[model samples]
Target: MAELIVQARWLVTGVQDRHTPIGIDDGAVLSRDGTIVATGLLDEMKRLAPTATVKTYPDHVMLPGFVNSHHHVGMTPLQLGSPDYALELWFAGRMPARRIDLYLDTLYSAFEMIASGVTTVQHIHGWMPGGYDAIHGAATKVLDAYRSIGMRASYCYAVREQNRLVYEDDETFCAKLPSPLGEELSAYLKAQAMPFSDFLKLFDQLTAENQGQRLTRIQLAPANLHWCSDESLVALHEKATAANVPMHMHLLETAYQKEYARRRTGKTAVRHLHDLGVLSPRMTLGHSVWMTQEDVDIAAQTGTCICHNCSSNFRLRSGIAPLNAFEKKGMTVGMGLDEAGINDDRDMLQELRLVLRAHRVPGMDDDDVPSCPQVLKMATESGAKTTAFGETIGKLEAGRGFDAVLLNWKTATYPFQDPDIPMLDAVMQRAKTNAVDAVFIDGEVVYADGRFTNIDRDAVLNEIADVLAKPRTPDEISRRNLGRAVFPHVKAFYDGYIGDGPVQPFYRQSSSV
Candidate 1:
């Protein structure tokens, strides 16, 4: 690629160092071969690289591209005909949706994410039906789509050894179901089951194959606490450690998961992971909504990151996470749109605004609430730590990849533009998908002016729609109906077996108050 100079009216570089300011008005970035060479005032950049090709955005605000720290197949469960049931039930209900080609399914969400200013995503793959060969093919298709679309992704197929859906063992749960449902579920489980050794082998194969890819990396995901056996979890940790790759897992996403941890291990989920020697700086816990104070302490001590999925928590009735508490403890926190945002789309700017406001408690003091700069860091720098691209894609600096989004200033700050007001704050509060005029990954423009440069958006959308229009298979219909039948028992298992434990407040009052 040719050297380029990108100048904007205002720039938010996402640099959080104590010595530098976060926003630079009338700034420019000079880049070559996907790496930023300099970022400073436009005049200084012009003086430094006089011959570079110049692209001026007089009506735009540029910043580091948003990183989606945790996600699962791009399609929302609700869009797949699964109502907003609790997490467990929603998993079952999503089985009936017509399956599309993995490439299209992955790209469908990629378009939403990129159009909304997200350039990187940690895609946690789950729920593939076939064994090793089928899953390997699916993984290749998903990664190929990301590579073809010019997006950065950390891909991991979630590993589950024992409990597939609920807290109980698969065979035991199947025994409770009546004839055809039980038989169907049993066969499904049998078809999907692969040895733990095979999963590790597949991880090694994928890592070897994608070692030097520009836009994709392979990682490990243990799925969840209830899903993986102790042996499998240990093996996964060892493999990831040996390979020096990061690990991301779902922990305490719901109250039921917390209860399951308590009943099974006689300790909290975080404590269990700590005891198992899996908690480390390389691990990121997704949707830690129900963590106790002790759990937070353990996480901080171990340097484990927490990814907050604000919208999905509300949609699934998973209670609000104490984000303020996590920040107060000096833990590294990242933001994620687990499946979709409040608008049922992957809009990161809106998700950032939601995260900024959701943790504000009843207080007149400003010190306790999240600041605009802090929330922006979570969406960019801190969020990048949770993925494979630890420090490479989050900031606009001398040595980092040129991943960024340019928001149209007219749409983001209209009717109330004041020079004195903080531009980052205004953009965070008012920005929407419509304002995202251009997006860049690896110093190349992938999306600009409402269209993707790498792929034909209309053709891809038409293909997805055509695939979904097909009638559901008989097996899929049976699975959907069976999921409804089993939903009550799943609820009863939690209610009768676990009961209600201590209730923790969503927001904790400051000690001074």
Candidate 2:
């Protein structure tokens, strides 16, 4: 019912035609009823929302609020000691050692995210079924919290069809275990798991609730890395296609995964998915860090989006994603934090900087891996597109959703006299989470001046601490034992396999663009 008129010193209306600041003074954006009405010179916008409550901030870069394409937002507790191992062992060990609750943890993570200038997040809610109901309820609470805060999110209630504790015949288990960890270990794990159909039914229930509440929507992710059968993958793809929603999963993340797919299907992971008819623009893959050049080509051809988990990749020693190669192939690559990071922070700016720097080809370096603008797109536009939110929220265009963040340039971006340098570079190199002065989603300020208006930060943290202190689930306990056995083996396997290969780093030959 109320209109908001904001006049900033500079506005980076993320429209491609007008990405740079239009003016140094008197630039404004008008929004009413949670939608942007106009954006232009301050004089023009003021006339559009003449009677509106006006808010102004000078000397800031008003750009679109970042969208984190892939993250386990609620998995904060697990990421605490994350830098110690690779991904498989990390998941195996940490899932058991950590306590996860969808409700409180989600809120705490969301609060952290929003405060750090992330307006939208795609959360991978990988919860086991023993506590399914509680997880669902907690997720619902999280969605409600997001709505109240005016944040956008795409949630994935991760569907893992394999249950480790429920054992099945050696033959069946062997068939599923991607070759290396075969029938022998399969006996230790479960084969008779919940059917994919059951997960679909659960998806239906969740979607029904979504329709009822007008809350945040979730995509259907069939776990990752050839974990689901062909039939299950096909079914899930079709369901997502029919429902007109996005589907996501981890892909080609580790050497073992690539090896597993190669041994089982005689193709790489992305290729295997393409053959299964699951490759499409609608599907967003996470941590495509191990993709080959051919895989990059395939992703380009199929228009499958990828979330580059830079922090997680480096932290787990997963190796740098072929980001430079992917760009050359013209594939869509977005930035992701993936549960752990430089500071366990959800700030995409930090992730972007890491992505830009880490992938540089060593020794023959010339600044070629990625430019600041490229990394910015990975965090903003590209990330939004992966979650099917790009059409509206990625940019701060006049007609698009007014989702933007304000950076306090005085503190974070000092000595800012040059307009020749792209604001993207300044934001990436100099800005910190504390520099995020305010954030607006759907045309309204949700967070500003170092405080959150949606939820109680202290209370959320207390609740998370309480929930995380609870006892582990039975499945988690089993996973812990399995991890203790498998970690040493995994470490040895990796050590033996990837033993001292020539490190090929990316470097920019020229700044043509």
Candidate 3:
């Protein structure tokens, strides 16, 4: 019967039918066993739970912690030697990434996320060289890292069956290559293949292994349309439905990916997935950057969710997602810092501001652009809907988990702030890591002031530095050589691959959908 109470100067409970949060000045929250029981004035909370432990923040503004709905790895791809190539070429560029231990790698990003008020992550991990056991071990390490640091993680081992290198099939593409590169690439893809049933088995095993975990949940990922066969995609959708989990599949991330979908199925990615019977509330499309008007209609009608990785699109040269269009259609949208953010790190505070400002489409159309509260909803409640944890962990309300962030009001509004500006708007636009006074998840404070409560962040970073400071392993050297050798062919595969014509732009303001 552990009870905790946070008496804060202000409490942002949640957003309702308004453009601002449902806030209370001089408010408090009472929780028992990690679930919020009541929210009201400080005196009311104290009367309700007199025996609860109280933590007071006199000059802080409390809000729900954010959810990063789509993520891949801990370290950024750029940090691992991959240039800011376009999405298609970036895959080849990432082939030679130096290895880092999965546990440490997960922590590296978790630290950044927590510091910026991100409490949960949809950690989509994949592209391993070993079979089921190896992949499962890797998944365990990632999960362990999240648990060790007290952050919540909805983890899914991304399932990639084909298209190991380019948009072409593995066997077809390998046959076109010359000399040892052919055998080398084939062997590499072969090492990653397993019976499709094994993927389901792995999901079941992970679910069982995480039955009683509060900080962990297991979900499914189909990797992407080009990487998954139709049969496997259907099977994964069925499995996820039966297991009561969500699927975050990367689709139409780039113009080339949109082209691939059309070439393969003679239809848009959304249409193909809809025909396959996979589009539903349970399916979350990672990046709908190049979706057509019809695609938006399909996604809206079928209740398919969207994850707008704003910075990832810019960094990879993927077109900006028409987020305003999605909102206009009443589609649920979430924010994700895929691969890396605009600044090449997982700072959700920075990511939030980027999303807020990026979608202003150069017009004074009141309803066409996103508002401050709308972006906040995307980061919190809508983002939670994309993961296995659902909407249960996104808001501050009765029956919801007690996860929140407290920002120093002075720091958030330092120097001078206009009284006409809303508190959330002022904070979103100006606050940085220094304003992040505390982060709470599951009724417990995991990060406070300048450090993680559960782990020594500096020690872990030094450990990573020491490991990388050593000479590259023989395996790493070989992969680097292979990447260099195959770079030319990989680039050549997309030579005039995209048909030049008037493709649909990011979005149209007024659609009848």
Candidate 4:
């Protein structure tokens, strides 16, 4: 019998097309027990729920909450002492990160994401060094952190069965190094190894644990094309199909990964996945930055989805994803901030602007580049599709979850805004994190006026600072040394991996004028 009504100065229910978004002036949404009952004019919504509690913001604009389709750890790799090395080298570079409490670490990124209006995250968790029970504890802590803060999470333990580092097996790579270093690295890799069945068991256990969860669900991840053996890929895909969940697989993130696929399968990564019958609507490929034209075509034809990690691509030298091409092929693509946004945080507002402006190919054709509605779609409904929530949580419509963000339109447009410019366009261009007035998930105010409702942001941040202030443990120092000693060897493994072949430049349009 619980009910609440939210009214805003402007409301964008969802997108209509590449150019139009279905919005209402003085919009309001009425929800009962976290499920939307109606959306329309403010007066109309009030009439529909006369006795319900109402929260109105006449100077705010409400839109569906953003979904970060691909994410990993709380602290960015850079903060952990990993420079912006290429994706391959960065794996080794990340070894220097100090161990921090999982709950505090999760809150660190959750604070950033929620402040920037991200209500849900695809938390792809993995690469732990321990047995199943230890990893299970870490996973529990992550899920608990999100739940405690009222953030929706679609969690997955990235299934990394082989190729622990580089594109070769761990044993082979360890053998390449000298003693002690080799022995130590081999032991570290072995500590993370468990039977493939253990991965499935973990999934089942996590799934059972989340049977009645309102804010979290377990999903599957194959880690990447090079990390997973073909048999593991097929098994994971089959498990996902049987369980009716989505699988987010990282594929062809770099040229070296693409080269690795060629060496392993004698074909492109996309083709190899296709040959194995793993491409489907239930599969979301993360950072498809190096897919061939044919691969894009196959993905589109098979109804597969893509997550464009715009910031990660830039930070890791992973090259630009063919976002324009994906759109031209009528494919569904979601936006992912990945490690961090352009400014080194999980700012979805900034990520939206980056996605909108980043793909403006030099052209005069209006449809050639991304439009406001297209980018909004990617951030909302399309992004939701790639996660376990799917269509259930996107768009502010009846029968959907009441998850949304209320932005302070007055401040966002403070100074002046032209009437000729569309509202959505102007807001997207001018809005920033400071303008995020409040965030709603499941009809509850999780964040409002720069404050979180369920957790103490400052206290958690200070606790994190206190922990990092203390000296690193002995194990951390040992791992740091191992990471340093193994850097050069790891870098040398990719020598001529992609070959010194001629490369094609961006296609010159037949006519610019």
Candidate 5:
């Protein structure tokens, strides 16, 4: 049977040269066999698909589903109301104390994303131990969760090392550890020890394995700035060159990270990555909010993408990204809410609006620059391109995957000066997460009205509660066993935070099992 959906108003495509609306009224989309076969006026579509079942979305605004280019999906619940501190302090306090389970981990973040109308996301699974076994099991569960819920995803295995004790001066940390323990940790942390020769190898594996799946694509994300080295970064570049997989990484979002990169490499963070030869068309740098002009030029030249997380950057006081400048340079930028904090809200529309308003740099006005629809383009189509699914998804055209969002406009309708302006402006500024009336991926309606077709919402919520309520893992217990030693560092970290607020008081305590 043919499935048809008609909307009174919809963006049939992006705006044309004058940035004026190219969308049509009484727009309709027809699909069969999980593809958009036709899209035009209601009567035309009806004539095209005679005897087909039709669903009229009279007051709903239809648009391409939002794709969140950067996220850490399962890390949401553990760090709620965390101390409004720097990134280092947040990760230090938060990661060590919390425990996570598969079901809860999947449900908490997955539902949050779906609720926010983020049908596609790239979740960098970096928290677990960097070993084959540690990664596959937990990651599989998360992938299964996403698949079950009908969310599209680009799942990345973070390849790099982590320092357990950030407080110990580098020399002291190296010298004080028993040589054997140091060796073991060293081996574990060494980028040379990881599987997958390069980014391309990983991409080749993904394309090889995912023969039929349309919603999920695999990606390559180097763990973090500190975890990867010059050699490892080059390996990544080689892989990117070989397979053409999109490379995403956390970069210069934190002050300490900025300082560390400068002090260690004698260059800015983005410049250092460029020096390592990792800047290219396959690169999607997460949180390039702290980049310099030189860095922006490098990004533009190399055709690198920026996944802008407006709320997360400001919430953590990482400063606003130069969206206006990036757009002027013809660089493609996508909107994102980095996992946790105020970023936890999956509503990408709010994030998109914030991106437009937050970075107005002292001298620019609205008309002098891009419009809200351009930013929405970043959120929807550009986001899909930021990951491995660059060409496979995004726009709602024939032969592309049927990933789309149907928004409810009746609740938030307002008078507009020009009907020619795209619907994105309303969706960005006026609509809320609840306004997402329905979402579809691969022509299957995953979320409709207010419920998930593939998952039990309450059951998922309860699972997250259960996992968080469980006792911390053995490794966590060992870290807690070192609580006395860790406390001094934790205290010092909180004490030196720039904002003059009560540190621990800002955060809600984790509930004991």
Candidate 6:
């Protein structure tokens, strides 16, 4: 491939340097063979790569592509009418979604993410009831979609030995329900069950099958604390350690989860994981909204990463995460749009702004707030750490892949173009999906001028619509009805268990007034 030089009016390098600003005025990046060769002023880059083909964007700002650290099922749940219920109840409504073509489903969200400037995603695959063959096919289709879209993805099938749906065991939960519903749920759980050993074997199979894929890598997830038994957790840790791959799990995402940890292990989820010997730098805990200061300390000491899903927390009424505290503890916190953002879309730019404002704790002290640079890093470099890519794809430097997004300055930096205003702040606050002009991954332009180069966006959406237009099967209809019926019991169980009034918000205290 020929050398490529991309010049923009402004560039945000997303480099990890506290003393220096991330933006560079009149910046350019030079790349060849899918790797960036240099980043510097336009004239300097031109001098370095004198004969390279140049692409100039006089009215755009380039930044490292965003990474979504935790995601699952793409747009399946939302497209099928699952509202933003609490995590536990949401699963019930989501269970009935008609199985559409996995490739189209994955690409639907990939389009939204790429249009919103995201280049990497951590896809936590779960809830495939057809067992190993079904899951393997779905995983392969999802990976194919990502490859066709030219986006990097870290894929992991979530492993759960118990508590498939509700917090209680299947027998206990079924026993509490009426006769046929109980029988139906029990049978469903039985059908869905896969042994812990089988899941590990499947993981090894996938790793070997996709060993040299350019844009996709395999990882592991134990699902969550309550979902996995102690033996399963230890086994997962050992397997991941032996394989030298990252492990991500859902931990303390909701108040009930915190209580479950207390009831099940007599300790916090973080402490239990530490005891299980899984809280390492390779482990990333998703939606850590309800963790205490001590849990944060343990996470920091163990070099674990946290993926903060700001919109999912707010939409599901999962309290705000103590992101400020996490930062204070020097923990690596990455931003993620778990299911979708506040706008019910995977818009990373808006997600960034939401994260920047979410942690402002009504204090006049500027130190109490998250800066633009801090949030930018969370979306880029820090987020990359949560995926299998690690430090390879987050920054713009020599030897790093050219993964980036170009924002149209006309919309991103409009009305307030004062030179004194920080460019990064302006982009974060004002940029929207419409402002995204182009996106690149591994030195290739995947999306440009509202069109995807690798895949036919319109054709894929049309196919998905045609598939979804079909009537739901009898089994699917029954699942939907039963899920709705079971939701009340699930809610009541949690309500009775967490009877201590209301859980306080992370930043609020009872004596503050």
Query: Which number leads on lDDT?
Result: 4
Q: What is the TM-score (0 to 1) of candidate 3?
A: 0.98
What ordering of candidates by lDDT runs from best to worst? 4, 3, 1, 6, 2, 5
TM-score, predicted candidate 2 vs. hidden true structure: 0.85
lDDT of 5 by residue, 1-513 (tens): 646554456644543432453576668777776678877887887888877667677777777778888877565533642455556656544534566666467666777777666778887875555445545656677777788888888888776543433532434454545565445434433422445453345445555766687777777887667766677778777766776677788887765666667767899988888887788878888887667788889899989898888778877777666676688777888877777536556667677677766655444456545577777788777888897788667777766777777777866565432557446566667877777888878778888878889888888777667766777778776544443344355556435433453422111224458
Lowest lDDT sum, 10 consecutive residues, model 3, at 503-512
Would you estimate the TM-scores of all the predictions? 0.96, 0.85, 0.98, 0.98, 0.84, 0.96
> Model 6: residues >4 Å from true position, as ranges?
17-20, 501-505, 509-513
Better of 2 and 4 by TM-score: 4
Q: Compose the digit string of candidate 6's lDDT tens values, residues 1-513.
A: 678899899888875642244767889999997789999988888898889888999999899999999888666467788888888888776767787778888998999999999999999987778877887888899999999889999999999878878888989989989988888888888888888877888888889988778899999999999899988888888888899899999999998899999999899999988987888999999999899888989999999999999999999888888998888877888988988889888889989999998888886886777888888889889999999889888888778879999999888766667778777777778888989999989888999999999999999888988887889888889888877878787777677777566554668533645
What are the root-mean-square deviations of the candidates from the true structure over C-alphas? 2.4, 5.0, 2.4, 1.8, 6.9, 1.8
Superposition error at 37 for model 4 (Å): 0.8
Where model 5 places Cα greater than 4 Å from the true spot, the runs are: 1-8, 15-21, 75-81, 162-208, 341-343, 367-370, 414-423, 470-484, 487-513
Q: List the residue pairs that clash in candidate 5.
A: 199-239, 200-239
Off by over 4 Å in 2: 15-26, 75-83, 131-135, 163-193, 212-215, 362-367, 415-420, 466-513
- Per-residue lDDT, model 2, residue 395, is 66
As a TM-score, model 4 comes out at 0.98
User: Over the full model, what C-alpha lDDT does candidate 4 score relative to the true structure?
Assistant: 0.91
Q: Residues 1-513, candidate 4, lDDT per residue (tens digit)?
A: 889999998999999888899999998999999999999987788788889999999999899999999998887777777888998998898887888889999999999999998998999999899899999999999999999999999999999888888799999999989998999889988888878899999999999999988899999999998778889999999999999999999998888888888889999999999999999999999999888898999999999999999999998998888888899888889988888888889999999888887787776998888998999999999999999999989799999999999999888999999989999999988999999999999889999999999999999989988988889899989889999999999999988777888865333434648
* Pick by lDDT: 3 or 5, better one: 3
Model 1 spans > 4 angstroms off: 15-21, 506-513
Mind sharing the TM-score for model 5? 0.84
